[model samples]
Target: MKKILVTGATGQLGSSVIETLLKKMIESQISIITRIEEKRVQFQAKGFNAFRASYDDVVSLENAMEGVDTVLLISSGDQGDRMQEHRNVIDTAKKTGVKHIAYTSRCLNNRNTLANKLMVEHFETEDYILSTGLKYTIFRNILYMDAIPQFIGGNIALERGIFLPAADGKVSFALRSEIGEAMANVLLSEEIENKIYNFTSDKAYSFYDIATALTDLSGKTVKYTSVETNVFEGMMKQRNLPEPVILKIVDFITDIKHNQEAGIFNDLEIILGRKPSGLKNGLKTLFGL
Candidate 1:
C-alpha cells in the first residue's frame, strides 16, 4: 500500500487533488500536511490522516514525511521566498527517504522574453530537484481560467469590456480543479523519474477572444481594450494595489502580450482519459451565466 502525503493540503489546488484522491483510493492511503491546526482538524474529522507541517521548518516537514512513500509538494503560496521554502521541502523529502515527489511548476518555454523575474524561481527549483537524484514528476501548469475575471478586473461584465496591457498573446488556460485532478492521477501512477508534463487546455485564447466569447454567451457587447503597460500599472495603483503586486501583474501581462503562454499540450488528456475543459465552458462556469 502506497502512502501518499500532500503538502499545502488546504489550498485550492491541494484540496481539489485530495478530493480526486479520495474517489480513487482509500483515505488510509492518503495524508494531508497543512500548517494550520484548524485545517488539519477539519481533514481529520473527515477521516484523513492529517499532519501539521510548515515549509519554513525542516523538522516539521521531515516528521510529516515519515512513512510516506510518495509526496506532492505543492508550490508554496508565498511569492518573495517561495524558492527557499520549496528548497526546504525538497531537501527534507530527500533526507526523510521519500521515494517520489511530484511538484507543481509554472509553464515556461524556450522564449527568453517569456522568462519573467518570478519564473526564474521555478527554473531554479526544477534544476535543484533534478540534482537530488530523487524520482520526480514536474507538472508545468498554465494559468488558470478562473483568473481571467480577476486579471481583467472585477467590473468586466458591468463595463462590457476587458482591459489589459497584454497585446494579442493567447493562453491555453485550464481549470485549477482539472489540473489538480490530473495531478492526482499522476501521483497514483507507477513511479516515473524525471518526467515533465504540461497541464494546459487543447485550445488557446486571447483576451479579445475572451471578449467575443462573453459577448456571444451573454448577449451583451464586450470589447477587449489594450492599454499601455504604464497605464495599466497606474490603473492598478488607483485601485490601491501594492507596488510589488502591481509590478508582478505588469510583468505577467507583458509576458502574455509576448505570447508566452500559447503552448497546447495533450498530457492533460492522457492523464484524465478525456479532453480537458474548453475555454467557453470554463468561462461560463466562472461567470455563472
Candidate 2:
C-alpha cells in the first residue's frame, strides 16, 4: 500500500517521471495531480489515480496527499507567485502527514542566473523546504540538454548560424528524460534518504561546442558568434517576442556566458548508476540529425 504522488503530472518532466514509475511500480501505487482535465483523463487511462489539483489550492493539495507516503513537488510553472505555491504544497504535505518530499530546484549557487525572477523564486522555495524539516530530496537540476534547441534557437542554427550573447560560457547540460527516470528511482528506493543532489552531464559544453556538434551531425558548417547583449535583444524584439520572455531569454544567455552552469557532478551517476551521454549524442537526438 505504498502510495506515491506526482505533481505537475502533465509537464514534460513530470510526464517522464510518471512514465518511468509506471514501468517500475503498479498503477495503484501512483497518483498524478494535474489541473488539466484532458491530461487528468489521459493519466487516468494509464491506471493512475489521476485527479485535479493546483498549487494555489491547498485544500485540493491536501486531498491529493491524503494517503500519499512520498510526493514529488514539481516546481510550479506560475510566473506570478511560484514560491508561495511551493510553500502551499509543502505545508499541505506536512499537514497531511506525507513523509518524504522531493523538489526540483535550481542551482542555488549560480550567481548570474539569480538575476532572473524565477531563479530567485526557486531559492526562496528551497529555503522554505529546508526550514520545514520535512525529509526531502533537492534535485538542483542544471540546464536540460534537450533544451539546447530552445535555448540556442535550433531553427536558426542550421540555416543561418548560431548567434548568442553568451561569452565563452559552458554548461553541464543534462537530458530531462534521464533526470526524470533517475528521480523516479530515487523515489522508489528505500535506502536513499534526505539529500541534496546536483543532476548534470559528466562534462560541460560551451556554445562553440554546440555549433561544432550541430555541424558534425547535420553535415553543415554551423558557426557560433558572440554578439553584444543589445544586438541579441534587438533580434529577439524583432521577432515580436513579449518583453518578459525576451528578458528571460537574455538572462538565460547571460547566465551561460558567466559559466554559472559549468559544473560536472557525479551525484546523478550515483542515482542513475551509469554515465550520462555526452553533448553530441544529445544534440543528435534532439535535432534528429
Candidate 3:
C-alpha cells in the first residue's frame, strides 16, 4: 500500500477523509499530521502514523512528510497568512519528493471575480501546484450544506428566520462529509490526476428556498428577509456578535449576491454515484426534523 499523508487531520473534512481511508485500506497506508500531542496520540492509538507538523513551519513539514507518497493539502483557515502557509506546503511537498498532491479549494472555477480575499489563496495555490511539475488534483468545493446552521444562527435560526443581504442569489451546497468521502476516493486513484473539480450540489437554491425548506421541516413560519448590508450587520451586532463574526456573515451574503457562491455543476454527483443531498432533506437532518 502506498503511504498517503493527510494534512489538517483534526478538521471535519480531514477526519471524514481519514475515516473513509481507514475503512477502505490498511492503517499502514494512511498517515496524518497533527501538531497537538493528544490528537497525535489518539491517532497513534488507532494505529495510524501520525506526525507533528504545522503548515507554516517548513522543518516540521519536512519531518512529517518523510515516506509520504501522496499528500492531501487541506487548505488552512482564513486567519493569518494562509497563502504563505500553502506555499510552504507545496514547496515542501516538492522538496520531499512526494509524487502526488491534492488540494481542497472553494467552489466556482473563474478567476474573474473572487468571493473573498482568502479565495484568492485557493486560486493562487492552484496555479502554484500546477507550476510544481507534480501531478495534482484540485477540488473546488462549494458552500457545505452542513454550514447552514452557522450561516444562519444555529439555535435561533427558526425563530430568527433568514436575514441576509444576499437577496435572491442561489447557492449550490453539499454536505462536507459526503464531499470528503468522495475526495478520499479521488486521492487513492492515480487516474484522477491534473484535474479540477467543482464540488457542488446539482441545484442552486436561494435563502428563500432555504427558508421554505426550514419551514417544511420544522413546522415553523420561517421568513426570508433580504435586508441591506448595514441592516444585517446591525442586527447581528444587536445580538452581541463579535465584529469579526459579523464581518464574516456579511461577506458570505455579499459573495452570494455577487454570483461567486452559486454553482450549477454536478462534478460532485458524478463522484458520489448518486444525487447530492437536496435542501429539504439536508435541512431536515440538520434541524432534526
* lDDT-better candidate, 1 vs 3: 3
lDDT of the candidates, in the order given: 0.85, 0.86, 0.86
lDDT of 3 by residue, 60-171 (tens): 9998788988899999988779889999999999999998899999886456665465667788899999999998989899989998888877848799787888889888
After superposition of all CA atoms, the RMSD between model 2 and the true structure is 1.4
TM-score of each prediction: 0.96, 0.96, 0.96
C-alpha lDDT (0 to 100) for residue 283 of candidate 3: 84
- The lDDT, on a scale of 0 to 1, for candidate 2 is 0.86
Tens-place lDDT digits, model 2, residues 113-212: 4556567777777789889888999888988998899877776689889889998989999999999988888888876477888998889899999999
**Candidate 2 steric clashes:** 0
Model 1 spans > 4 angstroms off: 158-160
lDDT of 1 by residue, 124-195 (tens): 788899999999999999999989888987546536577798888899999999999999988877656669
lDDT for 214 in candidate 2 is 92
Query: Candidate 3 — which residues are off by over 4 angstroms?
Result: none
Name the TM-score of candidate 3.
Answer: 0.96
